[model samples]
Target chain A: MLEMSQVSYQVGEKWLLDSISLCIQPGEMLALLGQNGAGKSTLLKVLSGECRPASGAVTLSGQTLQTLSTNRLAKQRAVLPQKSRLNFPFKVLQVAMMGRSPYRGERYQASAEVVYDALKATGTAHLSERVFTTLSGGEQQRVHLARVLAQIWSPSEDNQARYLLLDEPTSALDLIHQHSVLEVARKFAREAHVGVLAILHDLNLAAYYADRVAILRNGKMLCQGEPFHVLTPATIYQAFGAIVKVMRHPERERSPLVVWTDQTESQSIKTGKRSVSQGINKSA
Target chain B: MLTSIQMHNSPGGTSCEAMREITATHRSENVDAASSVAHVVSSRRWSFGIGLFVLLVVVAVAALGVGAVSISPGEIISILVDSLGFPLAGPLDSAYQQIITSIRFPRVALAVLVGAGLAISGAAMQGLFRNPLADPALIGISSGAALAAVAVIVLGATLLSGYTAFWGIYALPVAAFLGGLVTTFLVYQFSNFNGRTSVSTMLLAGIAINALTIAVTGLLTYMANDEQLRTLTFWSMGSLGGASWDELRVAAPILLLSIVLIPLQASALNALLLGESEALHLGYNLERVKRGLIVLVALCVGVSVSFTGIIGFIGLITPHLLRLSIGPDHRFLLPFSALLGASLLLASDLLARTFVSPAELPIGIITSLVGGPFFLWLLLRQRRRGESW
Candidate 1:
């Protein structure tokens, strides 16, 4: 388990994270949702051990995060930041292979196999020979996801639990890729028993894929539980200052779909166009 | 949830073990296609590395033979071998041997050392800063070192006499090293904010620091005696004409240290291209790597500038060209940059000496004349291509 206990992070007078406590267990996916500046990224940074919280603690399994060696920590967890700035023209395979860096002295063939597997999982095997900079933004995001996947591809020999943290992993991806990327994460969580924590914006997607959902408002977690419980219309309104309606998914009984209630002029125009198309279909 | 085997059997499955098994069953065919792509890239890198090393040696040897009193290549090799305590199977000319061992050898050796040192340091800096334009000379490291060296030269006999007496010959390089280290640190600190480095800010910092150092160096020049003035002027323009065995003895080990140590961080540098946090997440102790790189760059650039003056653009141009050709894998880039840098400087020094016969132009002038235009061309190309920096 990767656990944060009452973690608080502050900068000057402002609190980036206010006594936030969360636990991610093996074989589960937790989706964190929040508006911009709601401290979702800060919480991820704190959990990844990139920054020290003002108070409280983060631990991996039974060990405190600060006490672990960098290599050990790296082996146990991989982080995919929201925006990756890789200016150099490294090939796709080369970028993905960097994920195997922590496993020093591992044979090239072994690492390559893992990298190839990761590329395949992310649907990027064909891009292995292409320069990473040439890839589309969506493709680049998937490549980075592949790199992170390759980092903790297999469980440790000692059966130690591993964790994967992602900040907006699907931000640059297309709709199909967005689902595919989340599916890859869900697959890893289920099959590999790796704990996965991802910051997501799409409530419906989170509800469909994540075992649990967490919503943050003003540096504090508003709610966290199974998607149906935490993604209620009230909590959504409180967190994002927007009115929404929550409905059960037609196919998946447990999943919920979030619908925006406060429609804008453009949305009304879109609705009018849809109604005109329906009338045309009826006449035909 | 589906079991691992069921997940693997699914059409949409991307399971690792199943993929591995499938790949293993067709391992020969699959591995060939994949490894062949990798093999071609690696093989090309190897060939380029070997080719650059050979070119360096050929250029060095050819350079040793092409000076004012031209010696034959055979004589140059025999003299070099004899000096290494391995006499070739022929009688060697005494005068040619003296010229090779004493004069041309030191000049050529210094050129190689300075070039490799500058180029590797430049490559490392470019990697460390994650900016393609980062260079020792461009970022004020060279001028900073030059300022310290000029101070020691102008004041050693008067204001800094006691200090000079204490350190003797070690004073200038030491001072220059400190200056370079401080300048690099300041520029780094100025450009870095909130864990991000702005390229424009870094370049602006470099420009500002360069202006300040040049102003101070000029002030020091104003107070120099005629003899000191002459030395300072030639030194500022940069030259390897004063190359002697003693100066090489002082500068070579430091230069060699930077050349040797920078490549070890090649993997870390490769990771760093992703970003600082990414490199750290990859398990590199980011602080240690940053500190080690800064010190090594300062040690080499400072020591090189102390001896060879402010040779520009070798660092900037060599790595850029090599990166364009061989890709940005620092494992290949660092060592290859050193080799190419050595060849470039040797070739440049050769031109400096022979271009006008008996009168010699400072090697710095030649490098700048070539490098300045190359820098502009690079800028124009980058702008045309719509690259960010």
Candidate 2:
């Protein structure tokens, strides 16, 4: 298990994460949802040991995160940031091979096999030989996802649990790729017993794929539970400041679909005032 | 899905259309062709290494034989073998042996070492900064060394007479090396904030340091005597005519150490191309790697500048050309940069001496004249291919 207990991170007088506690079990996918500045990325960073919390602790398996060597920590966890600024023309295979750096002196063929498997898992195997910079943004995102997957491709020799942390992994992807990437994460969680934490913007994607969902509002946990229980209309409005309606998915029972409702248009019809476009025209 | 509909309705739809066009074109290309290209890329790395080694050997030998008192290749080989305590079949000319061993040999050897040092340092700097245009000069190493060289030249007989007497011929290079290291340290310190080094801040700091050092050097030049000024001019323009066995004894080991050590960070540099945070997350101790690289660069470049003055473009262009040919894997790039850099400097030194025979043009002039046009052509080719720098 990867656990964060009462972690608070502050910059000057402002708190980016306020006493947040969360845990992700192996063989489970947890989706983190929040508005901009709600500290979703901060929470991920703290958990990944990129930043030290002002108070409290993050533990991987049973060991405190700070006490672990970077190489040891790397073998057990991998992080994929929202944007990758790789300008060099490295081949995709070479990029993926970098994931196996933590396992230094391992046979080249062994690492290559792991990397190839990771590329296949992320549906990027065919693009392995292509220059990474020439790939489309969505393709690049998937390739990065593959790289992280290859990092923890196998359980460590000590049998410690592995974790994967992704920040907005699907933002650059298309609809199909968004689902496919999440599906790969879900498969990894289920089959490989990896703990997967993904920060997601699409509530419906989270509803369909994640085992549980957690929402943050103003650096505080607004709610956390099964997606069906936590993704309520009132919770969505409270977390994002946008009115939304939550309904059951027609195809999948117990899964919720969230649709944003325009308050201006609805209120205009009720009060017999100008429509949204007319308001825009008046402002212009 | 509702999300897909909203995405289409959003203002990003135009970019989405463009992205689809790109994807369509990409899908049309053969996947097998890409795999085959990858196979060729991996195989070509070794072949390229061998080819560069052969090229360096040929260039070095040709350079050794093409001086004012031209010795034939066979005689050059015989002289070299005789010096190594292996007497060849023919009688070796003592004068030819003396010239080759005492004069041209050290000069050529220094050229190779200085070239490799500058080139490998340049490769490492480019990788560290993650900027293709970065070189040793970008960090003010060359300018700082120049300032110290100028200072020693101007002050060697006056206020610094005691200091010069203490070190004798070693005074100038030692001062220059210390100067370069100090300037680099200041730049690094200025850019480091809250335990993180901002590469942009480092670049800006480097610019500021370069301007200050160059101004100081100019002041020193204004204060110099005519003889001092003449020496400074030749030094600044760069030359191998002053090369001697004693100077090579000091520079060779330092340059060789740098050439060997810089490539050991190949994996870290490769990871760094992804970005600093990415490299840290990949299990590298980022701070240690950055500091080590800075020190190694300062050591090699400071020594080279101390000995040869500011020989430009070798460090900047060699790794770049190699990257275009073999990709930017530093494991290959660093060593190849060293080999190619040595070959280029040897050839440039050969031209510098022979082109205007008996009255040598500065080797720095030759490198810039050749490297400048070649670099511009590379940029043009890259632009034509629709590749971004």
Candidate 3:
């Protein structure tokens, strides 16, 4: 399990993240939702050990994250950056093999079995022999996903749950690959008991796949919990200022579907003082 | 119940497990073909490596045989064996043995070491920058070394003669090595901000330093006396004619150490190719690796330039040519470049001797003249084949 307590990251005078605390339990997927500059990526970076928080601390399995060596931290958590820029023409298999870099000379090596299994899991097995640079954007994204999977291939001693932190992983993918990637993440979480934190822009995808949802607005948490409880129309307006209607799935009632409404009554929600009066005026 | 999500079909209407099985089946079919392709590529690289080694030996033999006092390969071998403490029982003339042992052998050995050092440094620098055009000298390292060397030659007998007099033959290389180190440190400092080195900023700083050092070298050249001026010019163009047992004794250990340290950096260099943040995420301390690479390159280039003047393009083109066929796996590329570079320099020196017999051309001119065109052709081919760097 990964836990953060009262972490805040600041740049100059602006607080990018302000006193935020969150926990990722084993065998669960948490989706982080926010607008473009809402500190979701910054929070993810702090969680991945890429950025240091201004105050408070992060712990992995009850040990302080700062005390862990880089290799130890890497073995327990795998981060998939938004884009991977490889100047040389590395083969897909070689690129995947690099995921095993931290475990050099160890018994749990990054073997061909792990690499090929990751490729197959991501549905990128056919592109194993092709040059990575020659592949298209979506294909490259899948290849990188495979690389991170191969990094923390499985749980080790003491049954520690590995964590996967992904930043906009599906932004470059198409519809089919998007669902497939999330499916892979979900399967890995449930089967391997790995904790997953993914920053997603698509609300429907997050609603369908994420076990818990956290929404951020202006570097502070607006609401978080089960999707149905937290992702209400009022919460969506407070976070995104978009007047979206929360509806149940046609067949699966537990899941929520968000639909945008184009009406003046929604416009009243933006103007704070006259919202109640304007709602009554519109009805009349 | 969370596992129930895995049973949800994708947009393609296939469950995750079913998709995995399909992908596995497809990959199994292609595995043989892919493995065969991999086998062919590795074998091709292996043959290329062996071929280069063989070519180096053949050229070394030819180099030994083709000087002004042309000795046959058999005589060369006999002289070599006799020098190894077993006088080959025969009618070998002592003068032939003296010329080969005293003059030509040291020259060939120096060429091999210097060539290998420069080429390996270049390959590592290229990998560090992640740019195909980066050479070992791109950061003004050679210019700094050249400036110090020119200063020692012009001012050693006049202003600084009191101190440098004791240094004797070892003075120039030592000064050059210090110069290279100082300049690399300066460049590294100028480009680094908050613990990260910006490649573009570093490149721009290198240009500025190169300009300043060249201007200083020009001033030293203008101030030199006629004898000192001639020495300075000869040093600038570069040659293996200055090879000696003494200089080799000082240079060989440092060059060999650099050669050993550089190839060990193959994996780190490979990680660097993925960009700095990715490398950091992969658990590499970017600052340490970058600093280590710069110091190693500076050491090799400094020692080389001190002795051979400025041998251009061997460092740049040898790696490019080898990388074209071997791919960018530096574990193989670094060693292959060392052999290919050693042979290329040896061959160029041989041509410099025989091309205008009794009147030697500087090896630097030959390298640039040959390497410049070859580099252009490689770039042209890359463009024609539509491969964007």
Q: Pick the candidate with the highest TM-score.
A: 1
Q: What is the TM-score of chain A alone in each candidate?
A: 0.92, 0.93, 0.93
TM-score of 3: 0.90
Off by over 4 Å in 2: A265-284, B1-40, B156-169, B188-204, B387-389
Candidate 1 Cα outliers beyond 4 Å, as residue runs: A263-284, B1-32
| Cα lDDT tens digits for candidate 2, B1-389 | 53564376355233223222222343323234444555677788999999999999999999888877988988988888888999988777898999999998999999999999999999998898787877777678888988887888899889889989998988987888878788878887987776455778888888999999988988899999899888888767788888999999999998899889999999999999988778878898888898899888888988888888888889999998898889999999999999999999999999899999889999889988988898889789879979765
- Output the number of the lDDT-best candidate: 1
- Ranking of all predicted structures according to DockQ, beginning with the best and ending with the worst: 3, 2, 1
Candidate 3 lDDT, tens digit per residue, B323-345?
A: 66777888789988889989999
Q: Which candidate do you rate higher for TM-score, 1 or 2?
A: 1
List DockQ for all candidates: 0.27, 0.29, 0.35
Docking class of 2: acceptable
Best by DockQ: 3
Two-way DockQ contest, 2 vs 3, winner: 3
- Note the residue pairs that clash in candidate 1: none
Interface RMSD of each candidate, angstroms, one decimal: 4.7, 7.9, 4.4
Q: Can you give the lDDT of residue B60 in candidate 1?
A: 92
Compared to the true structure, candidate 2 yields what TM-score?
0.90
lDDT by residue (A14-73, candidate 1, tens digit) is 998999999999999999998889999999999998998999999998788889888888
Q: Which candidate, 2 or 3, would have the higher lDDT against the true structure? A: 2
